[model samples]
Target chain A: MTADTTRRQLLAGGAALGWFCINGSWLQSTPAQAQADGFAPQHLSVAQCSAMNVIADALVPGAHVAGIAAYIDSQLSAKNDSLLLVKYLGVPTTAQSGFYRPALDSCIRLLAADGMTPQLALTAMGEDAVSDWQGPPASFFSFVLRADALDVVYGTEQGFARLDIPYRAHITPKKPW
Target chain B: MSNALSTDTVIVGAGAAGLLLAARLAESGRRVTVLEAGPKRSTDDLISSQIWARRLKWSGPQVEELGDHKVGHAFNAGFGTGGSALHHYGVWLRLHPGDFRVASDHGVGLDWPIDYQTLQPHYDKIQSEVGLSGDADAEIWRPEGAAYPMPPMPLFAQARILQKGFEKTGRRTAPLPLAINSQPYQGRAACQFDGWCDAGCPIGALANPLVTHLPRAQKAGVQFEHNALVSRVLRDPNKAARIRGVEYFQGGERHTITAKDVIIAAFTVQSARILLSSAADTTPAPGNRFDQLGRYLTSHPAATVFGLFDEPTYPHQGVSGGQLLSHDDYDNKQQGNGFGSSQWLIAHAIKPHDLLGYGTGRPDIVGNQLEPWLQDAAQHLANMTLVVEDIAAPNNRVTLSDATDTHGIALARTEHNLDARTARLWQQRIDEGQEIMRAARAREVWHGPRVAMHIMGGTVMGKDEQQSVTDSFGRVHDTDNLYVSGPSLFPSSGAVNPTFTLSAIASRQAEHLITQQ
Candidate 1:
């Protein structure tokens, strides 16, 4: 085999988990188990993962099934090789987790407060209405979460197919980016 | 001579400009060596994934950015062999005559040391050599030059839909001049239109340095040392006016490579950084005699307007750089609330995710409403980008950061703030862009955030030594052999993609250098 083919194979092998998620096995795990042990997050705590899932689901439903937290965790784990949308916004790869961690913690804390619904929480974030919003602007955090949710939901070949968009490939990616 | 490490010309950065210079100089029998900070890259490395493409972007030392609008260095610059041009959308365009003399005519921004007439021949030569595709006659607002070497790529349905908006608004549009091939040319294949231009076109369709200049340079025996991060330009201790060579890090070891001439074409920020870092205890940096090394830094303020048409627009059918161009407002630099030029690049082939992606644009869209909206918009969405010129201000500059990289070289820091006039122009164009989309029979229309596109003018070229880092030929005013190239030499940020203009400038510099040699 050629070196190019071998390289592609290695890359594809390395990205098998992402491919599995893209192929819809991401929905197999229940939310509780997924947050618990189905896929252990390297960067986020279980509570933080749960919070991310909740917030991401509110931003883009099916995000839990689409494995938004797992996707984000996987990206965060990759560090400089991350595919997270926040990378494009001038956030250094080294500081990406820092950008996410406290924001998710703050979100979790806000959601746990008395009588706070997901929709209301999201609305408050959109309006920047959170009084004690911590770690990056709440509006900015919401925007990032929404973008991340979109990635898991609609940034794949199957995802494109669902949208009726042709997944035309000059060189079809063996795995989702 | 063979045993010695020194070369005739040593270029820091194996980017478009550097590679072009290397190939030309090497072909003329001058030994050329290029030092690239990033890893070696071939076309095989360009995987068709945006996530993988991140590897192509600037992953070197983090640039500390400050200002209302940061230069977006991380997004705009590139790493490895081909540099930022590796992931560039191939929208090759010429600067208008007015673009060359912004200060002389409008009493704003710095004027280029050379006029359009001086660079026209070089543009013509580069266009012929590189092979651009467009209908030059149809480009009503184009400055005079030779016709495009190839016919324009066929417009997709999305472009046709957007063209209606231009017609209705009494504005005109022509096919966008692209460095990508319409048909096979010079053995390179035509573009596949997969809308993955930002991923670094692997098919050799886009005229990146890998496909265009790098190979030629290699064939001409131009030596390239990858992962060689240049720290500073070294000067002869006795002769302060002469540049001796450069100090660089390769394989975790510091090395010095001497040359007769040194060319710093390391994109905008790093180029300026290297010069700023070269400051010694006895003398200032090579081109910082007047503290003008990194002044007048500029990035075009750009925004995208998206519209969901009633008809099946099929937005994914063209290249990422878009299919059509409208320069109707480009010539009129001072218009309405703005003091600079603006143009519309219509019908870009978009993706579902990433920053400019259709999915990312609609943050308000999500939940159950997301799928149907995406599906419909995938087929019917038409989008166009408005590129507004930025005025070159002395306050907008690149400086050396206090923070040092692993190699102990001070990291580059950039500060770029848009002039109120430029911001006003961007807002006005965005408003007009939405109106055009509405006129095109769109049911829904929206615009994206105003962001920096192409970067330019950190080491600006001008006639006056006191006001600029380089002279008309891109030679540092104080240093005899040290020079700068690339978009960083621009005195004014024109409302056009800079690759064509920068390549032409490099070509002009090449001729001047060869003649002088």
Candidate 2:
């Protein structure tokens, strides 16, 4: 098959293909099943979420490998008790983030309306390729998306740079009693 | 039931000073109990987008004020066991030696009876226990003190960029001494360097009270009563001079906790409120005889300069306040100006919502056309900002509002009350910061209006009984066994975060209180 044909087929069979995309161990050890896990319902559509993932990857470039979006989504969808970011930064309202989903939906819809797919739209949008998809109001949506991106990229093990990991680099220990 | 909560000492407020004091006291076989007004929070509560955590703040029954700018917000202290420390950005710096004697030196603000040298050892002790990460060797501008316990937190794209500007302009930028682990130490993990510290850390990496000190205090059998709002300090009929106990309300129940001594670890604002609320009957009037309880209050009004860069600074990679600092030029109090010293907190990676949005004074903007800007901001996280300090003014005080609430306690009234001299001082620092940013090859440079920082100088510590409310050791002049801790003891709002100095002061007071007992 041609590259475009295969791409279309992959897109059409995304649910099946996504099975391999998720590491089996991670799926099994999902936070939902963890004793401390408080789960929130996933409210967005596949198309909308795929758009967010693509845009987030473009925002940080290395975010997917860093597993940032998953982390952001986890914190966003987890039980209020399980999510720590809300408590620390005082995100104003914990019941609703007020920015994440609506911003994601707007970006996807605007980009899609301009005759671009989710992935291509995000990459093109970065280069200022699509003029019509100006994203959210100048600073507000930018703030939410930037925080979400960082929540994923920097909040993760790779993101925190594993510097916090004990037994890795021992330095200047306190005198024991 | 009394046996359920027994301790040699009970510390109120669970911020940096209280937590450190509790840990140190607990180490010496003292059973310590900390009563916090906020909720009981942990790292797990930090990462969620939940609403309750954000609602953890001090909102008296109702607030009535007359000013364009309302001083007290609904959420002031974190409504958890950790207190406001849960939301603090871990930028740890000692107040300058001169900061201790502001009135004596410049004749501008009230003078602290004790000098910085007196608090130096405590600074060292807290730094050692907390594990500060910074390049002590490079901080030539820093005053005499023991070196930081750990190497500096790694400089990111923004620090490197900002350093170049400082070099180009003949200015200086050193690694900010942070109470975050650069490498694993003290049985706790180091900073993950996620820059999400303002949001709280989940892995117990940052030296927040809950993770670092409170846990140890608990291990040493320190009992904590969360969600307890202390209403007033009740005195006995016989020794109306000495505090008998504290009257508090929790879960809609009015209860009294008797103690030999009462330590007000509540923050400057709340501490002043509690004093004002109780002194209504005890002192024959609110802010009675001395007129010193909450009159000379001041919070270091800070301004920030943001510099945008083309490179991917990844500002979100490190601490919320960033890695590098600029105090070499700003630390000196300008001559002939009534302003005290001012310092620079650089490369702070602000979140788009609060940091970039509300902080920049543009909280209203929302809707479409935001994604592209965010895409750019994510890559350019390496931008820099300067937390320029403002001078102390007595008029910049916290007062009890005449308007009473459902609970009958008065609300906190505040006015920005900045002086012309301090306003000029802010302008000078902003100009210098702008020049530094321009030298660094920034595409755009802008500064935010001055915003208030860690509380200061309401119930100041002094030598003379007539001038101040508390003595140098934080003991009330007339009332025995009533001690105050934290920034409320600050004689001046020096141009630095008060957490470190407050810790040192609290430690000193705790030693005195222990001996006096």
- Chain B TM-scores of the candidates: 0.98, 0.92
- lDDT (Cα, 0-100) at B228 in candidate 2: 73
For B1-517, candidate 2 gives per-residue lDDT tens digits of 1322334566678777778777777776777777877677766666521122343444334333333222333334555666677767778888777777666766677777887788898888888877788887888878788999899888778788888988998877789999888898888787776656655666667777878788878787777887777777776668766777676667776766777777788887777777777774445322235677776666665667767788767665667766788787555676355355677777765544333431222322122223334445555644455444445555666678886644556766655566677766777778888888888888877777665556566677888765677888887776877777888778777777877888788778767766765
Output the number of the lDDT-best candidate: 1
* Candidate 2 lDDT for residue B432: 80
DockQ of 1: 0.50
TM-score of 1: 0.94
Q: List the residue pairs that clash in candidate 1.
A: none
Q: Pick by DockQ: which candidate is best? A: 1
Residue B150 shift from truth in candidate 1, angstroms: 0.4
How do the residues A1-177 of candidate 2 rate in per-residue lDDT, one tens digit apiece? 243442332223212111011322333222212111222224444455556656655554333343334444555554443232333232423433354566566676656675665446544444445444443442344444444554443332322332121111112111000
Model 2 regions more than 4 Å off: A1-177, B1-8, B48-76, B280-288, B335-338, B357-369, B404-406
**TM-scores vs. true structure, each candidate:** 0.94, 0.73
DockQ for model 2 equals 0.04
